[model samples]
Target: MNTIGHTIKAARERRNLTKEELAQKLRVGTHTVEKYESGEQIPSNQTILKLSTVLDIPTSELLKKQNI
Candidate 1:
């Protein structure tokens, strides 16, 4: 099963962005990004919106979690 972290990681990869690059774009610390990808933390809704924008994916897509 996929989690939000997996979705975030996949989307970031699809954009060819490293965690550091994504963190810079999101104005967050690299460790924060790492935590998000590692499923150790969950981003706020505001951050999720930012992720959707930065990743060029829909908010709904970011919300999805399933076997992909």
Candidate 2:
């Protein structure tokens, strides 16, 4: 099963967004974005919402575990 990190990374890549760009939009450090993509950390609900908006994906998509 794909973790949230994997989902986030895929979505971000689909949008052609860099980690730094995503971090800047989220008001976070690039390392934090890295952690999120690495499954070392999980973003809060607010952050998830921001990510959905920034990535142009549905929040439900972000919350769902994908089959990688």
Candidate 3:
């Protein structure tokens, strides 16, 4: 998987959030979340920022970077 997908998966698992649950929280479709996890697509910038907030991590972490 890509770094972005790997990071997202790790964070989601740490938070105990299923794809459906995370999608619901993001107000996006489960397919979107699936694509993200599968590394088929990347989330939009706004979505990444929102996910970082919802997941209680910095955007850099979500981006697979050590610093934001």
> 1-68 in candidate 1: lDDT tens per residue?
67889989999999999999999999999999999998888889899999999999898887776332
Clashing residue pairs, backbone N/CA/C < 3 A, model 2: none
Candidate 2 per-residue lDDT, tens place, 15-68, comes to 999999999999999999999999888998899999999999898888887432
TM-score of each model, paired residue for residue:
0.90, 0.91, 0.85
Error in Å for residue 58 of model 3: 0.8
> CA lDDT, every prediction?
0.90, 0.91, 0.84
lDDT, candidate 2, equals: 0.91
Error of 3 at 57 (Å): 1.2
Residue lDDT tens for model 3, 24-56 = 999999999989877778888999998898888
Top of the candidates by TM-score: 2
**CA displacement after TM-score superposition, residue 11 of candidate 2 (Å):** 0.7
The better-scoring model by lDDT among 2 and 3 is 2
* Candidate achieving the largest lDDT: 2
